[model samples]
Target chain A: MQLSNRLIKWLISGPPLVFLLIFFVAPSLIMIVTSFRLPGEFGGLAPLTIFSEHTSIDSGLTLETYQFFLSDWIYLEIFLKSFFIATLTTIICIAMAYPLALLIANSPRKFRNLMIMLVVLPFASNFLIRVYAWMIILGPESTLSHVINHILGVLGLEPVTLLFSPFAVLIGMVYVHLPFMILPLYTNLEKHDPILLDAAQDLGANRWQQFWCVTWPLSLPGIFSGSALVFIPVLGMFAIPDILGGTGDIMIGNLIKDQFLGTRDWPFGSTLSIMLTIAVLGATVFFTWLARSVMRSP
Target chain B: MKEIADIPEKTMRHSSPLLRLIAMLVYAFLYIPLCIVIVFSFNDSKLNAEWVGFTLHWYQTLWHDHEMLLAVRNSLFIACCASTSATILGTMAGLAIHRYKLKVLPILAFTPLAMPEILLGVSLLLFYLQVLNLTLGLLSIILAHTTFCIGFVAIIVRARLQGMDESIFEAARDLGATPWQAFYHVTLPLIKPAIIAGALMSFTLSIDDFVITFFTKGIGEPILPIQIYTMIKVAVTPEVNAISTLLMLLTLTLIILASRFDSSMLRDPSR
Candidate 1:
């Protein structure tokens, strides 16, 4: 009976464990090792050792890639710029999503599902198509751009280009990720007790005061969770910048992509990826701490 | 608009006019671009600046384009292979985690879903080229898709299992049934809906994926998203709009079907 039980256990769990360890775990380790190695003569990693006429030389590993990353200010600038864009996107998502989520959560229970489904429906569409849609809307010949430019002309200001600008990039980021913010915030807001709001109102508090004291404080956990979802993906995003932004708009993702495909610098690419992973982990920890404290204080 | 009317009067009184307007504007923001894309697919103009007249020229162009057809074929093939393998592996992982309460399996299954997709793409690229020395092609792309998709399937199935009664499995075992028989008769029938939902979700994800596919798909093969990417980058045409509209229709159908199987699948995995 004991032997058979053990056999059943292995039969069930064994394949997935072996598959993940081989494919997921092994590749992650390879990426780390690749980060420490030197760039080859052409593109990939260099040989572990070079044998000369006289002696065998070990050229296997170096911290040169890390040194280059720390020495340059451009990489740091890109990191900061990416963070700025991500933060702005997260804040905008919250502002837009909060009112909508609150409305859905407060609506009749029968209508709540349909309302949430509407938010998710657009998200189910192809992501590239969503980005491409913006390309059409923001193009100079589109109606929106023409209208804006005409208004600017009437105001005696320079006619601004909408496509391939930071504004367009921000719009695309928020559009692609807005549903992430709404879903979590709605989930959190829906669970709030209505009696608490009634109590606050009975205590002679106005609507705004009730929201500030009771609702907003209670929704901090949702906001933080939503922010993390929006922020992390935005940091690692390359397509939005690549397609929507102007030539000057390069995020850390674009830089990392360039290393592999453009420059063929495997070591530098891996190094950049490792740095990004650290940044993502740091932000996650910070968000968790903030959420915990906010939850405790109330 | 009808949805707004359906809101109960007490709750409607609570929602301020400013809040309603903002919510309406937010819904508009979500939908207007998609409407424009669908409308423009049949447009007669080449520039796509304004509509001239409705025509089927773009759809005809798409039909005649051999490269686009091949890309569609590749995407369907890859989505099928990847989703099937992921469903099998992920169902096992989910069952094991629920029954055995294994420590490491959950993290190994789920971290891929949370991590930035580009990291997985780059790591797999290096592993395939440097360690395995395999050429980048459809096979490599399928393997990469399966690795990430396992997490989605596992999460759904595990959630379904968690909600189920443990007594059913115990009853089967007490009735002189083997462990395998208990799983087959009691557990499999109950979790069927979740398994179908997970499989459908995996299929949709694999088909729509672009970021990971961008890095892992080495040269020469024309995948659907990459084709669309090149078209958008190189030039704007109504043909691209037509393809986008069609892809949107397909995804919409699949998503509706999946939700019908399991409504809880609509909830975010982070929940």
Candidate 2:
């Protein structure tokens, strides 16, 4: 009986663990290892022939890949730009999502579900297609831009070129990630007890005071998770920038793609990948700690 | 229930006209692009600037485009296979984690959720090319999709399991049933809805995935998103809009079906 029970446990857990280990964990480890290796003659990664006299130091195991990235101002600029854009996107999403989530949560039960469904329905479409839709809307000659430019023209301002600009990329990022922000906020807000608000009101708290003291603090968990969800994906977003960004608006994701596909510099690509992973993991750990500390504090 | 009624009154006062206007605008932001795409699919001109007249020529063109059709078929095939495999592995893992008190299992299972898609894609690409020495194609794409998709399925199934009553399994076993029989007859039926929901959700994810597929699928036939991507990069065409409208409709249908199954599961708990 003991043996059979053990067998059952293994049978249940073994497949997923083994699959994840082989496909997910092992590949990540390989990427880390590959980042330390030297680039091959043409572009791709060379074999990691360590401590061999026949191999040159440049082509052998070394830290040149990391060093190259650190020494390059262009790469640093790209990383900083990616971080800035991700932060901006997260803030915009939160601002846009908070009231909307509150509205949906406070609606009648039947309407609440329908509103949530409407928010989620756009997510069903292909991400690329949706981004493409933005591309059309933001095109200089499209009606959306035309209308905006006409309004600007009435104000004696120059016509605005909307597409292929940093603003366009920001708009695309916010548009694509708004659902992620709204869903979590709505879930959290929907579960809040209305009695708490009434009690606050009875205790002589005004609307803003009640919101700041009660509602906002209670919804911090959702804000953390929602920001994490939006920020992390936006950090690594390549397709949006590729479609909407101009030549000067390249992010770290674009740089990584260029290293791998366009430049064929596998080691450099792996290095950037490692840096991105660390940035994301670091942000998540910080946010988790912040949330826990806030919850624990008075 | 009285608390619910009084709660609305307290909350409704906060929903000022300005707040309602902002909410309405946000909803418009969320949906206007989709509506525009659908409308532009019928545009008579190739460019998406002006509405010359309403016509189905773009849809006709899409129907006749054999390459795009092939891409769509490939995407569906991959989605089906990847989602099925992900469901199986995820269901098992979900069961194990819920049934046993494994400390590290939950964290390990959800790591994929936190990992950036670019990192996952790059790592998988390098692993395939360097370690496995395997050619990049549909198989690699499927493996990558399943790897990331397992986390989503496991999460859904775990949530379902947490909500489930364990006594049914005990009852089945008290009636002289084996462990396998208890699971097969009792627990499986209980979690069947979650498993199906997870499968459908993963199917949608796999179909919509482009970044991972773009990185891993080297020199092979393009998937639907990749094809659309390449077409858009080369030139803007109304045919792309037509196909996108179709893709949107298909995704909406699948989502509705998935949600229907999920609601039914929630309603008929005795089953």
* DockQ per candidate: 0.53, 0.55
Per model, the share of native interface contacts recovered reads: 0.57, 0.68
**Real interface contacts reproduced by model 1, as a fraction:** 0.57
- Leading candidate by lDDT: 1
Candidate 2 runs further than 4 Å off: A51-59, B1-3, B6-11, B263-271
lDDT of 1 by residue, A155-274 (tens): 999999999999999999999999999999999988887767778877988888889998899999999999999999999999999999999999999999999999999999999999
Which candidate tops TM-score?
1
**Candidate 1 chain B lDDT trough over 10 residues, lowest sum:** B1-10
lDDT of 2: 0.86
The residue pairs in collision within model 2 are none
Per-residue lDDT tens digits for candidate 2, residues B6-63, read: 4546555447788889999998998999988999999999788888999999999988
| Poorest 10 consecutive residues by lDDT, candidate 2 chain A | A50-59
Query: What is the Cα-based lDDT of residue B90 in candidate 2?
Result: 89
Computed on C-alpha atoms, the DockQ of candidate 2 is: 0.55
Instruction: Give the number of the best model, judged by DockQ.
Output: 2
Relative to the true structure, candidate 2 reaches a TM of 0.95
